[model samples]
Target: MSIVDRALNVKEQFLQELKELPYDTHSIKLFKDKYLGRKGLIADLFSSLKDETPQNRPNSGKVLNELRQFATREFEAKTVYIDNQNSKKNIGDHSLPEDPYLIGGIHPLTHTLNEINFIFTKLGFSTVYGPEVDTDFFNFEALNIPKHHPARDMQDTFYVKNGIVLRTHTSNTQIHTMLKNKPPIKIIAPGRVFRNEDISVRSYCLFHQVEGLYVDNNVSFSDLKGVLNYFAREMFGQSVKTRFRPSFFPFTEPSAEMDVSCIFCNQKGCNICKYEGWLEILGCGMVDPEVYKSVEYDYDKWSGYAFGMGIERIAMLKYGVKDIRLFYEGDVRFLGQFI
Candidate 1:
């Protein structure tokens, strides 16, 4: 065949190869390799320039350029059409529900924290914050746990350096708030707390705590009970019962452990509650006069209540999560359930 005819035949074969091809990166790459790459039909056509007459060379060159332009336009058009189709497929049935991956949710810990905040916020408590690295004065002394106090042993605190330590409780924020801000101060301090402890199913070195403070004139033990009762009901269920047992904390006078009815069996008891028919949910009490003295609040004029609960513990009970360590471990299997 003539050089022009041979080039035409190759062009026909190239077009045929591309006729049923999908317009995507892979297909475009193959088209370039088979028809436009170095040694491809178009390159062969240019190599034949020497075989043509000088008069016919210019016309032949122009025709070859036109054919190349046509092929390019065809490829570009198909690419645009394919892209539009992909976009349409992605936007399919907007009225329909989204796919599982798109319907992500908050982490269980986050959800529990939100619920706790919501419950307290409704009771006129504002959120408060303080540094995680706290001085011994605020984290310990201000909370009435002296350096020699046995209660400090219970905490297993991690000392950052001389007198400075990673706060063992969000209660440190309470002391900071009390010193900086005055009474009628209803605030909740929610954040992570650290300890020097071994990892286990029920315990971890790092955990979260939500510490609450309510101070004002005539804030009584009854008021403390009322607030905690409302919180227990709001969190566990309206039917859940709450009670207080005599306990001890350095920061509170007549401290008590707050217990909620076993939610799993509605107070009938279960493995979760250790068959006790009650679960100790938190520690709370009438604020100690010593705590007031540390903050320089007049004990006679101002009285209040303070409470603290472990976020991990609450979340575990609420969601039936068996392992406290799961909250710290970023296992996709555990987290995917919440998502």
Candidate 2:
């Protein structure tokens, strides 16, 4: 046959073989050798061009160049395909089992605060929030903790300039709420509070508190007891026992601390309860007349009750956590237990 015909046959055969090239390193190497190698079809086609007549040589050379270009393009594409497949194989098998992805959870203190909020909200108490930083008027004076009072010593406050302070308790929310809204106000303020204290298993420089306030005509200490009793049962368990012992706070007259029977010991002595079989959970009482007077409320006309509890303290007692520091430390092993 003519030189052009022979080159066309070789080109057609190479193109057909190229179409069947497998995407693998070994198969790609063999494909290169068959079509584009030194002794391959394109090289053999060029070798045959020298045997053609002068007039046939031009057409044969053009056909040979076309075949060379086509073979080169096909070989490069196949080489890239095979290289990518090998690279992916070297990287890893996507189908194999993978290490589990860790899931995140709420911090223990936040979790407890949410639970507290949920309980009180169910009891007709709306959730309220207030500023962390405040003046002595709101944080202390409004709550009947006057300047130079012994009660100020109890808080160990982190005071800022001009008598402003990082609020010692969420109870400041009570003053804010009363001033803005008339009586029949029921609110539970849950937020972070700061104090000047040494860090230890039982105490921290900063912690969370939930302050509850209920005001209206004839609001009584019995109402405070009933609400807190319900809270203790809801928070601890339906069977949890609670008691109120007379305590003192500048804001709440007839102030008392509410204690829950040690869950760890079922009211029997234990290290968790300091072997006393009782753990103080919160402090509460009727709003003192002075607190009402400071807020410009007629103490006789609008009586109320205010209660406050430490969120970290509640979390520790509920979870059997020994160290208060563990709540703040971002240790996965310790925090994961809550989840």
Candidate 3:
């Protein structure tokens, strides 16, 4: 056959093979070698172009380029098809059920803290914060707990260098607030506090506290009761009942522990309430004169009420959580219950 006829025959065979090419690595390689490899049909046809008659050489070159282009397009298309098929195999069946994805949620203590802040803010108390590591003056002495006072022994303190300590309560923020501004101060401090204590179902060495302070002329224990009662109703439920038991604290002259009727027992007997039907929630009293003296505020001109509550304790009471330790443990099963 003439060179032109020979090239046309090879072109027809190449086009036929291209159409039948299989979707797989081995099939693609074989198809390429058969028609497009260095020594394959298309390359050999191009090599023969120089031997063709001058008039036919132009026609031969055009046909050879077309053949080359056709083979290249078919090779790329097959490679993409094969790659897609392999990827689908590696991914497995689409109908199969997927493994569960666990979503995270806020911790119970944090949720309680936010709720407490919201309640106090509604009562016109601005949120304030202070250092977790504070000096003895601010953490203790400035709050009227003296170095020689027996009340100092009440808090199992983690003392740091040079009379500084990890604050045992958020009340340290009270001193910081008072020193910075003059009264009509109404603020709530919320933050983590550290103590030296054994971890137990009831207590942890580290916990959260929220302390509220409101200073102005003529502030009284009745104002304290009114605010806390409103907080109890907002926090627990509209029907929650609250009372104050006489107590003592170095910073507050006439301290009292506030208690709410147990929601679990509805004021009836229950282990959560120790069968007393009441759960102590927090402590409150008028700010002590000594505290004002330490902060250099005139005790005669300014009086306020300060109250504090443990966030963990409040969370435990609200959620019926039996163990304080569970709050710290990173158990997904326990935490997932909150979500």
Candidate 4:
């Protein structure tokens, strides 16, 4: 049919539907949405105006406008009628107690991620993100983890079809960042990473991480220590003592794991600290020369450090949450306490 004929049909159908609409909210909403919503029949009629010939465009537009105005008035009148009908009916007990948990608070993991990002952003690191599902090249090969390297074993990854895998760490963001921007680069990649590990109280197949990177001339292990020490104090408490023990990672040379004294036992042993007086918090080291080679940067001219920490671990420590599973479980009672 022509635009005018279609508009006339729609107008008649709308009037018939509006008059037949029962005195109820549900029917009224359906009538309104069918004719008056953005993608409704009336709107579709308006959109079809471009197909009308130039000579007929003005007349077709006027007809559509009149139809819309009439439909809108009818819809509003029906809505008011339904509202009046609903108001006249009895609503249930007004004196009943309000729901105890009416409002929701931020998830502890999210709060912890924000806290880590805020601390580093204040320290001159801009927050950056990369894909959770990435190729082995960016996820591994670009960070200097070649295919036969034992570092591939460090993170049991979930491989998708055709050699793509869920990223093992947001450290993948480092490769993405350095490729896009030149140095004096400072960024923190806060995102989710996945592993092929078995689920347990302490371990899950998936978790969140904040991977930090800094690159420039003369950046050093000393600079890494100073920034991390300040972060440790800020995140845990002003009195928390931090120490670094030599460790290894494929992407960083001279790597170490950082630990803070157990706050719960007051420097005494506890299960949360694995009966040790210290709790390992994060891993860090000077960026490996191989990493610079992967990104085509001159290792001698540039120096930097990379660090990563799990969001769940930090939330567990900060909130005394023993099970890492609690963060993932949809337990509002457990989550509600954070408020």
Task: Answer with 3 or 4, whichever has the higher TM-score.
Answer: 3
Q: Give the top-scoring candidate (lDDT).
A: 4
Q: Can you tell me which runs of candidate 4 are displaced by over 4 Å?
A: 1-101
Superposing all C-alpha atoms, what RMSD in Å does each candidate have to the true structure?
8.2, 8.2, 10.5, 18.8
For each candidate, what is the lDDT?
0.87, 0.87, 0.90, 0.90
Off by over 4 Å in 3: 1-101
Q: What is the per-residue lDDT of model 2 for residues 112-177, given as tens digits with 9 covering 90 to 100?
A: 888998999899999989999998899998888888988888869887898899998998888888
In model 3, how many backbone clashes occur? 0
Cα lDDT tens digits, model 1, 146-218, are: 8798887787889989899999999989988988888879999999999999998988988899999999999
Stretches of model 2 off by over 4 angstroms after superposition: 1-101
Task: Provide backbone clash counts, one per model.
Answer: 0, 0, 0, 0
Comparison by lDDT, 3 against 4, better one: 4
TM-score of 2: 0.73
Error of 2 at 262 (Å): 0.5
